[model samples]
Target: MDEKRLIEQKIFNDTSTYNDIMNVPYHQSKRHLPMNQLDRAFQFAPFGALEGFNDLIQEKTELYERKKYTTSETELTIERQLKYLQAHSLKVDVNYFNDESGYYEHFKGYLKSLDWKKGRADFDELSVAILNIRSIKLIKK
Candidate 1:
């Protein structure tokens, strides 16, 4: 036979060699156990690097939609309330806009002092900028 035919005949007719390779058993670990269903499932699980991304998006969305307390009517009302508090030295609750975070925060205590010239108000221990004031209300008496 020619060289090509002889090589093909030798390779294709090696059925015993293929049979031996197929019958060989896979190697098993001595100490390590085979993966269970849960462990095997984890191997194919998807991975993400940006954790808490959903929460961050939700926080930003809420911040963007938040209402401001700066309308002219609201400003006038708060100014009147502030004057009343200062004149009476009233114990009041105050909700003021926090410019740094663009949100409202509250303080309920005695009105210690008012500095209209400086545009600031002093509570029991806290000094707040008057321009930041949103609402003021007399508490009990």
Candidate 2:
């Protein structure tokens, strides 16, 4: 196994050790610690907060992984399609291209004009359509 994989596996297998490493004295000492009853409350407060933050991080990591996989697949599909299009001397839609500011402004206008639910549905549909088109073109080639 690779070093990164090995380290991740170790962390997973020994969660206590991972927690201990993360909770090193120097790090803990840097934080503000309360006194008496307030200390207990503060300590428990951070535990709950940290748990919530960890959950959010895990969720974001999963999302990032999914997006990365999708992006890589889409890029490969687009590259294959471009090659095929070149070979066949087919014209590509130039309307897809827009300057960064123009694209952002379009979306900003879209957000301002549409209802939240409708805009979200449209976004999902467009995303799926783009991915499907690229995937299909790649498979065809």
Candidate 3:
């Protein structure tokens, strides 16, 4: 046989070296109980070395993906629609820019009230700031 096979044969033939310990039982700790598979798995689990880094990256990505808005382009259209809708309650779909998330949010609900002095638009469920409104379309019943 080749060198590898010869070595394996020799080792297999000579089992006396490990024979003393071959039948020895495994040792167990008395003070601590054995961990379950899941508990043991968590011992080798990966951890976040840099806390809040993911949140920072997400905030940065949202800022880059934000849609740019100009008052000149949409102000006149939104104002006219607002004036028309102010007279009566109506179901409307509104797309407005969210300053907190730097994104546009779509809201569909019944318009309840509008405050010109405070610059706020109240819906049945929630209220949105007037200046942040991008487009407002009345839902025809």
Candidate 4:
């Protein structure tokens, strides 16, 4: 019989002999040799390669989707600040218009017509102060 066929027949027919052959140090060493080299090569690759691949994929998806900031927290914050500034400016305008002696009564009428629900308490207080000053000025007039 050929050597290879003899070994194959031994492996199939003799369990103890097959186990001894498999347990040999030379065969054991060969099993781990390639695996150790593969592990070392993977460890030596650049640290950011995997991370860069993920980032590149994310950027491409964002471009494909045309990602936007419509619902972003910062955008909402900026919109709220703009509304507050508009309300605050209205309060300041009412105060400035009320400061002129002749326009006091007209300013009081305008203040009464404003929607205070959308404005801050600071704006409300400034508006009230303007109305009060107008009242005083009317009394003096």
Candidate 5:
């Protein structure tokens, strides 16, 4: 009677149109195994497009959490300890702020040299600015 009814009768109610396909049985391969729903879902799941991006983000967040403001007293104490360690050539554990990354880094090594004029402390493994030093202690053997 109406356009909607006409289209529905011609398409949906047309049993002969789908009868041939409906009667056909599903085909299963003899060699290949069927995939489970979980495995099939994983095939279309989203993945990380940029490698190492997660690690970089995690490192940044950890740095932010570890960063702290240093006081003048703390700097003065570290400087004093550095001078003593340099004079005695003692093995030490040091914590210093890295300006580039805005995080504190630890070093456990002998103090190789200290330049008061240049304001830097040279360790067996690395050199750090004196002003950036947060704390320093002798590594007891």
Candidate 6:
């Protein structure tokens, strides 16, 4: 009836079973696993518990977003700055927006050419859309 007695009786009943199991000597497995500590750890590692959840959070919490539209005054300012860039043709840091992701990103380098036809400013191995241009400031060397 008491918890102590109940446990004592159960232990007494299982004593033979425990003795049978304990009587045997510990035996090594015939085939040994080749798993290292790192591999064993990897097996229990957390994996894709919420796949794409982190990416979704990152997208929502992005540092910058593209403007809905550029103002007329801002457009004029950019045009003047671009002209200066063309005349000087100096290595500059360009801040621009990505149309696809609607996020602002920047790079520092020399312009390969200003592609007016394609509406993209081309750099060595990189190009950004003209419409997405935010600000271009000359990087003084």
All candidates: TM-score: 0.46, 0.22, 0.49, 0.20, 0.49, 0.48
TM-score of 5: 0.49
Please give, for residues 22-111, the per-residue lDDT of candidate 2 as tens digits: 866654555766367976787778556565787777765654442322477665765465445445543233112122212211111010
Candidate 3 off by > 4 Å: 1-67
| Lowest lDDT block of 10, candidate 4 | 132-141
RMSD of each: 14.6, 16.5, 14.0, 22.3, 11.8, 12.5
State model 6's lDDT. Answer: 0.75
Candidate 4's displacement at residue 50, Å, is 2.1
Best by lDDT: 3
Best by TM-score: 3
| Candidate order, TM-score descending | 3, 5, 6, 1, 2, 4
Runs in model 5 lying further than 4 Å from the true structure: 1-67
Question: On a 0 to 100 scale, what is the lDDT of residue 37 in model 1?
Answer: 96
Candidate 2: worst 10 consecutive residues by lDDT?
104-113
Scored against the true structure, residue 75 in model 2 reaches a CA lDDT of 56
The lDDT of model 1 is: 0.78
In candidate 4, clashing pairs total 0
Q: How accurate is candidate 4 locally (lDDT)?
A: 0.42
Q: What tens-digit string does per-residue lDDT give for candidate 5 at 58-90?
A: 887776676676788887778778767767877
- Candidate 2 global lDDT: 0.40
Alpha carbon lDDT of each predicted model: 0.78, 0.40, 0.82, 0.42, 0.81, 0.75
1-141 per-residue lDDT for model 4 (tens digits): 899999999888877756757866754565554567767887788774676788877766655352232335544543454345544443223222232232333232222223345432233334433122211111121
Candidate 3 lowest-lDDT run of ten: 64-73
Superpose all Cα atoms of candidate 2 onto the true structure and report the RMSD in Å to 1 decimal: 16.5
Worst 10 residues of 5 by lDDT: 42-51
How close to the true structure is residue 135 of candidate 2, measured as C-alpha lDDT?
32
Q: Model 6, poorest ten-residue lDDT window?
A: 60-69
Clash pairs detected, candidate 1 = none
